[model samples]
Target: MKKENSMKRALVSVSDKTNLVPFVKGLEEHGYEIVSTGGTKKALDEAGIKTISIEDVTHFPEILDGRVKTLNPYVHGGLLARRDLPEHMKTLEDLSITPIDLVCVNLYPFKETILKSGVELADAIENIDIGGPSMVRSAAKNYQSVTIVTDINDYDQVLTEIEENGDTTAETKAKLGAKAFRTTAAYDALISQYLTAQVGLEDPEKLTLTYDLKETMRYGENSHQRAWLYEDALPKSFSILEAEQLHGKKLSYNNIKDADEALRCVREFDEPTVVAMKHMNPCGIGRGDSLEVAWDRAYEADSVSIFGGVIALNRKVDLATAEKMRKIFLEIIVAPGFDDDAFAVLAKKKNIRLLQVDFDQKDEPTKDEVVSVMGGLLMQDQDTLKEDCHDWEVVTDVKPTEDQLKAMMFAWKAVKHAKSNAIVVANNERTLGVGEGQPNRIDSLKIAVKHAGDLVEGSVLASDAFFPFDDCVKYAGEHGVKAIVQPGGSVRDQDSIDMANKLGIAMVTTGVRHFRH
Candidate 1:
């Protein structure tokens, strides 16, 4: 009489059995029948909980090496039937199928299987769940009549509701359905991406990316904006989004963006290099025999602006380098590593963020960069192509000296990270001045010259793009800049070249233009 009048049925099948015994026990206390298959049923029985086998529910034995158990209509018919519809009940009555009110299912471990060392293709393929996704979708589609649970984290809430109210509220059911759909979608996307790559396609025909929430930030770019950080389900090795934070408070949204920008720029060099950044532009960059010297050069490049900037180093931060760093008020400092003595010294500044990057692990940088607009996204290649002065042509009669050539290359690297209409002045290995985000090329050049002043002498100037007029070259010569490097593609390029020749300044054309907006 209790089974006929008050009992409810729950279908539970899961690969991850975390908290299964207690959750099932909670359901049983409220007169709910649990029907399970395979290892889940065995675990439930071992925990001294009652469970009806899939064979009893389907009236058929599991066949095809345990693959065909839940694929039967008996399971789906009960899970999907509309309780309010007479026709559905009539069909179920004719088939003697019990309608399922609650469904608990989680997908197979395809992602973990593929990540294991030496995992065979057959093993990965076998782990793909055909029945689990189908059951999840059916339960989600019937959320008006059924409750779905995909995550073990939701078990406590679900159990509490069923214990107190005897059923989940409509709002809870909708939310669970939404999560269930996302779970299956992510599972399918991983399988699709993995198989496409294994079949020799460099990229899949349809790119599918899935991410799990890592944290909810206080806010986005502004306090009014909402934001959350999500890491890839299968992360790449070199992504800063997945980097471990070694010290200091939790990273804010702005800190993550600026730190990532700083690190990416520093990776453009192989020598001992330091990059100081503000508002996503490189305020200073230095290369030296030691990181300590590099930090000083970079800081001296813009002592005032580097006060609250982020710093990135390509080599280890030693105690000497940390000494130079401890003087400045930096938002973040990241390096491949820090000497224990250096970390000990810097750790005293409790507020400054410190991060140790892993350079030994490797992954390809993203092929595409995406920008968000009002209604859509703008996407482009990540501009990862490297340029070399060795590939450049000497456009002026006066050849650049060996030292000047080296300085030009260094300035060229810095110019690429500056905003459009950019100009960077550098000596042999460190930046002297940077003029960025100007409306006109001449204005940017003037700003750099003013910043450099006497330092402009003997320093090479690097432009992000070709000069539309000869005035930039004239201005450079007046400031005592001895060499110039720019992409030579403008219609009046020869005019600039003529001015360089006339001013007795050496110039080289890199042929490649780097435009950062």
Candidate 2:
């Protein structure tokens, strides 16, 4: 039933046409027949490369507007048949099917389609490739007898092997098979994520997620532990990974973590702002009319704590700000952009990493925040909800002045980013002190008051959660705090309210808690 000395067959179908002509030409040079479908076949024909159409092989017209073209048994049987097994060869011979020795397939542009501006749901659904994944999985499953090519980067490797060894090696086929399965898995995960969001399914029965390996870090949080960075499949436009590294050595794990915290804190302000981050906590935050003024306020807030911290700015870095920053040792500086003179001044320090993140991109949508536990994972919606000062309820007898209310909101924003059991002491436009991650609220308040020192006289106070007891309020009063802002959810909220009134401290309840752990 088999034709004597027939050429090997390579089934090729891909949405990305990168290097398709040259790769197919090399396969032809190796005495392989090119089998393609739809747009791929037309492209091959235009490139003057001969190709056998899927319709010709299946002996059926492509129905459903070309969706049903490659789903036929003829194509799968050819790809799935094993050359070494006599029964498989007999089944192929009985069905008059040629053994397809290779399969080159990449799915449609579903990710690209969904990412397009104002794309409709129907448009996204139509772009999903059904037959391509089926073919890729079949070819990958039979990798013991068939070679699978999913990545365009592997085209040369496949060609080099064919040119040198007449066939791809067993190791190469196995690796490609594993890669193909990963590709299909990631593709399916992305589709599931998109559809789940479209249907407003908050908690899906099965949680499927995918990420791309962005970098292999030198180490994890510690030097002995190994770690790598995996970026989201659809990364947010405002993420640190989107930033261009203007100068300095590669970012360390700590550098990235601190820089991310700084960026998140700085984005909370609309005016020119600066945030200084150490570990994962903001040591200082400042907003001003000019970038230089903001830098001065942030630096003067806690000059000692910000010595080796990461700095994030919402505006472009100017020469004056750069000169001030050059005086201190900083791990990284992240900003929207940097002037030429500013860059030169900062680049003078060989070890500081400078990152330029675009501030003009559209606002990012809220995403799920996932944390890994020992045996399970915790998932929650990201806290991207903007808080309005007018929504706050005044719970105390003493009403806050406009300046004190502004300071309360400023401290509230800063405290939201700090770890739980956090406290922030701030003026109208700058954070004087911050304390977080304490075992008790009073202890955190004490640390914040001590950090603020003499500057705590007229500054307002913000707590991530309600006061468990009146002790925190009394301590804030003793420190000369002018006003307090908190979520006010505890059963003893009245006690804290009573204490605030006794101390003549204005208190506002946000009715919303921001707990970062």
Candidate 3:
């Protein structure tokens, strides 16, 4: 007699049972016996569709709270046996195992489970499905004989092909097998990363990264290079990927990079602030009591560079701010929110992208920043440290006044976002000039002072790193800079200090460097 019946036998186990009942009913219509376990069987039986319990096939009761149900050899033997091999068929017949032609399995919701707020460790561990992945891998390995279905979206296609051909074609089986393997791989990578973080394991022997494709960009930094954007599987709250784009054309590769830079810089200020960025560098950063004032100050900081640059605001965009922005040509505007009239005014500029990012959400304490190099990858912790002016030490005889100290802090925050070797000249709340990505610190200083021009006098300066020589300090003093802050670690730190005291300029040592590369 034929094993089971003169028809196909399918094993189905899934956490997501969407469209499962109808699909199984269709299979039964085509003379296939449905075998299921746990919730799947209950749902099928409730829908008036007959299902053979897994115990009937394995001859073993599910133990350990349904964990050991489908891991039995009877289940694996049927799914993994090659119908083309005579010995495999004889062994199945001797063991009385019915050959399983189809295996439809999707793993537990591990990613969703761990993402829950205050989820217990035991709960997350329990949600890690062991039997499901085993079945998927086994069936995928024997794709020549067993068809695997892991995605719910593929139900219609698979069912249509089976209806037309009486069985899934070999080509369809191979494609489904490849998709199943990819699903399991991504699932395992997420689990590995979560467990690694729980154990505080740094630099594991194997590094696996999983990301979902968010967008396919028109091009990369250059028009000739093809590019795509991938968001982190568990994205941060304050991310460009999380932002809602209200208006404008699709974002290009350079637009995303510049918008990211603008967001990072704007986050450094809690007050009403605006950050202007171009080509992944800050053109100007401004802070004021109101959003409109902040926009004016930021625009005044670098009116020339502000053209065709990204603008990020920490406060809601009002009609006043929107009116001021409408006068210039900006590539993008990002804010916490935009008022009705403000959005209507700005939306008229069809080419300008409008992004509303939520600033109320808190970010994780730490995140891994990854950069890909030729044939290798580099990973490091993102620089999110908040510097306190109280921790800084004054090294010069000329003491900075309270106003000057505040200006130095403002400059520090601006310089942190600029590229190295970076320098920022600012008064109290607005950046007068920014110079970055120069070969030498003095050259950066010269560029900044030139940008400042008449405004250089009575302004405070901040550097990302210590002065290698006393020349930068001497140059700043001659240019009439009132105060300076740098990570004082150089061997010639005293020389810079002596120069500051000689020129009656106040100098502060932060003992920390903020280098952005």
Candidate 4:
């Protein structure tokens, strides 16, 4: 590398000109020459900033509808040449090309184009830029002599450091270069995933993932460990992982985990529902005619556990609900939206995080889910919502009433939130008890009955998996469970149905099992 730092020359081409004017001005103020292409050049010129066209630098004109502009040898040679290598210098001299010290290039908005409903294939294909990734990779490969900037948010910081130090340090260049490669890699991964899905491909070997780090948490599960949050390709999906914090301290690892579980539980209900979660377990859950009533019922479900728990609501939070929530020491609260009055009421508790996520509209099932282990990953299909209730089979002499069937469905939804070997008992629209992560079905039923206490009378039960024996059904009858819903596939299904009939309890099979394990 050159021992002495020199005046920087930047190649700036971007489809998103969010901070282009100020960025180019900063480069000009720092004595850096700007070389841009096509619309980017026009944008800078219109913004009253001096710029050199890429055609002028390469001594060739842009052709093929702007696709052939920055792929020239001059551009790549300038970005890739090593200052310390004599052959590299000789090659550059032979080509009469000057080294590009910095590259601030972002690709065309392919993801944005694809996100638009009814977007044609031609439109999406045309948005994919060829030159942007090439220039980024070249600059990143030669990080010792080049600084690459792919994100507009980094523009001002990079400009400030260069202005103060004359040139970017090796550390800054290396960091920026790493980010640049990751940016292009993620972009390619997204394209591959989209195209593969578009063609109706079922090959699991073709699946790909692209994620970007949103923020680093204080710790993993505890304060002594480190953690970070990342999002997959889609940014429009308003997940707890994708939420932007409008106020309060950064989210801790436990806070995010609890908030995610709370969000998932609340999203399961179509009607207005409120769920309170602690340590990835639902402490309380309720649905009401109105959100305020639901919030109150959820709070009353288990008052002690609701303390410092994460609360999530399915509807827009009103002032009454916010006021009631403010009374407790909550870690976080999330809803689809908040009205002005509700926002004002909740804002008083500044320490709590309030997030708005449109769960009803954006609950698309993810294609792949990966869980990490000590040395590898376990991949599986995402747990998707089953919409067909009519397909469920009534397997008992005593069929459930319409109201009881609704409660059974609700209990089934609640069971999905519980851990494996889960059992949930509910009456009306409120969760009476949840038994989670038990070793067996009968044990789970016993736990649910024990937790439910007096509320188990006339309540409906939901099991995550099939009842292997009639012991669970007999146990439910003793707990006053009037109805039961489970996936029926075990060989002793007839015995279980016979037990339900003898006990005068209604039983149904969903055909589909929800095994969390």
Candidate 5:
């Protein structure tokens, strides 16, 4: 049986009313009646676009500050009624309820509320919409008989389709329904994460995460594997996933991952710092009074690894810095900001990925951190970057010199990029050597010393984790390591301390641990 195609009804409710007036008016022009609740209805009425109040449709007043407005069976039945089902039509007729043809809804600003300072639990709970999710889910589940619109961006398209064809296409309805479900899922995941964070259950087993795919990449690590970028919530900071490509090919999966890591590492410093990442691991890192010097020093740190790597800087990219960066072939170059001349210079490299990230918006929690085990999924908190170093305790015989102290702090920041069982040696704001992803602590120390070579003399070493034995300290001394920083929590802590005193190397315990694995 063919259903009647007379004036379709759309229920509109949105926290962000951007472009709502034109959209609602367009719907009205197409012989679609708008049913809206609370602020949305008020706004439409103020604009002289008549709307049926939700209370009129549901035959119930909005009590409890509008919380109980759309939760009734009338609302769900209108959205869920099967157009072709005889039983569904009979039920709707018996209740004297009109079937809802379309639902336009967006949840309250839970993500925004959590980001604001001093947001109380009551405030956060109040923002969680009960009726909104139910309506969205009902519309989505009955996509065959209903159309759902959750994003304002879809308003124009939906209006055009209805105007041209007298109804939305099945394909369009299916797509919108998919988007509606995704919206509700992401919203619920955010609420779950907030409650979990408040309770301090950060363990991987206890963590639950949900993210929507932002984009599918051209390829993964290689062209053979598939990859896509996802975001938990839209991050305000300079994020590769959020960046707009002015020109050049779409970023590969590896390019985005490496670019993100490099940007995060570089953004840690207020001063001009440059970080080059390859395959999601930092290959070169340096800081200087000027960005040009920093870029040059970082390139020199590991010129071989910097080839086709992602480079990130804390400060704005100037012409000189851009010129230096152009000398090498790179996959991407990201900075907090960029000057006109600098962007022009980089724009010439047609293939290089250029991104200007908002350093101010960079530190939100990632959507998910995944690790594949033997036929299982292992998830946990993202290896978030640390900003506090004041808690470090000096735990050595000789104290570090003022200059060495500054260099140690720099090395400590760099070491966070190294893989687990990592060792990093640096001096004068430059990474002298880095040993990462080794099986044992001593092997990582050996690699660091080997890479530093003669430069290891008078340099500071930073370990991502505590030393299990005194041999690591003795090895550092043999290579002329004069200062060390590690999270001192080994069973043989005294042995390592004694070894440091014998070698005359200043060591400090960071009380806090940074085990990447």
Candidate 6:
């Protein structure tokens, strides 16, 4: 075995030869022997740097399409043998093998190949590195003595430490070892994920998901719970998670959850829209020609419920809208962008969190919604269904007018965003009142009607689900609700139809229920 005091040997093999030429030169300056594979040795020689090939170290030529080079026992023994243990040192000493102090390597371009369009299976298979990961793992396992460097970004740090202090620190070795293991794990995960996608596995019995930690929170919903924010390994599109905080305190767990709901609701409208949320339920929603008008009407929809709520807008926030939003003590405000003056004004308040997300980067609505349970996860298709007036059947003898149908359609969009057992009273493309998360449909109706006050006379009512009995229709009639829209699949549908006709109310069945729970 080679003496540690005199000189050390380093094995350098990398598919990503980012800084290898200069790095290998540095090793030679410090009296270290560099051993590398075919291309690395050739490149080092071409660069006027001395490097011994693996064939010279193992006394065997690289064969079997170059797969048989570093898998030999001479290389493995040099890497795996412990210098501190007498038996391990004797094994290497008897075999005339030297101990490897450093292993600098990165995996094959498997990830790059998979990213290319129309890449062949044989190409992907050939790019999978066998000896590289094996050597990296071997060196990382002996981190007490062997330093494993996987990333090119770490090259300068390693070189600086070696130039200053003859050897790399044990702490750096441990950190680099951890990064090596993680890199291999991520590599295998990508391969598995890509193959699983190709085979069209809708729902595999075993599900594996990868996420990278983005932030560590002080606490969760309650201070007793610890929390962290992890982004998806491969994000599908823009989301609140990627939002840039322009001003105010960092978002809390509850704040992010409610903000997500608000943003998703506002994305449903193509016009200038505003949605205010509390506890993940939208309290106020409005659409108008301008964002200022939308913000005004949405806040007025339920002024009491919007306090300390999260706000989301689909359009750029102008100065007029920003000033109006600052009137209330809000937890968050999210939009695509803000006017310079508006942003300056909003920045005055330090506690309210402000975020900007791009409107063009919105995701497709039909993706899966995943819910985590005690021991597993549940996934289902997202509710992207839209109600068409042409598909609706007007059950009452008095049919809804064109304007009334338009109002009902607007109300349907809002009702879909509300929780189950919802009732929304909207007119002129704005919600006047909303009742959601109630135990019974009657209570929801009463709450919605009561909130509307006298405005319920000409407003159209929308229910997320069908009316089980005629009582809701009777109450809507008594309250002077002119039009009612609901999904008509109940066994007693005729009862509500009869009540609607008798009360001279126009009722329509959309055939599509918007139950959001």
Best by TM-score: 2
Candidate 4 lDDT over 252-310, as tens digits, reads 88898889888877877888899989888786789999999998778766788889999
- For each of the candidates, the C-alpha root-mean-square deviation to the true structure, in angstroms, is 2.9, 2.5, 2.7, 3.1, 4.1, 4.1
Poorly placed runs, candidate 1 (over 4 Å): 1-5, 61-67, 114-124, 192-207
Q: Rank the candidates by TM-score, best first.
A: 2, 3, 1, 4, 6, 5
Model 2 lDDT per residue over 382-433, tens place = 7777888878999989988888888898899899899989999999879888
Poorest 10 consecutive residues of model 4 by lDDT?
1-10
Candidate 6, residues 421-466: lDDT per residue as tens digits? 9999989657888999999999999989888888899889999999
TM-score of candidate 6 relative to the true fold? 0.83
Clashing pairs in 1: none
Q: Model 2 compared with the native: what TM-score?
A: 0.97
Question: Where is the poorest 10-residue window by lDDT in model 6?
Answer: 1-10
The segments of candidate 6 whose C-alpha lies over 4 angstroms from its true place after superposition are 1-9, 13-33, 36-50, 54-101, 106-131, 137-179, 363-367
Q: After superposition, how far is residue 249 of candidate 5 from its true place, in Å?
A: 3.9
How well does model 1 score by local distance difference test? Answer: 0.88
C-alpha RMSD (angstroms) for model 5: 4.1
What residue pairs clash in candidate 2, if any at all?
A: none
Evaluation by TM-score, superior candidate among 1 and 3: 3
TM-score of each candidate?
0.91, 0.97, 0.96, 0.89, 0.82, 0.83
Task: Give the alpha carbon lDDT tens digit for every residue of 302-401 in model 1.
Answer: 8889988999998989999998899878989988888999999888989899888876553355635667799976767777677767779999999998
lDDT of 3 by residue, 1-517 (tens): 1123358999999999999988988788877899999999999999998899999999999999987899989999998999999999999999899999998888899999999999999999999999999999999999998989999999998888777777888999999999889888989999999999899999899998899889888889899999999998888878788899999998889999899889988888888999999888888888999999999899888999999999999999999999999989999999999999999999999899999998986354546889899999999988778888877999999988999988999999999999999999999979998999998999999989988889999999999999999999999989989899999999999999999999999999999999998
**lDDT winner, 5 or 6:** 6
The 10-residue segment with the lowest total lDDT in model 5:
382-391
> In model 3, what are the clashing residue pairs, if there are any?
none
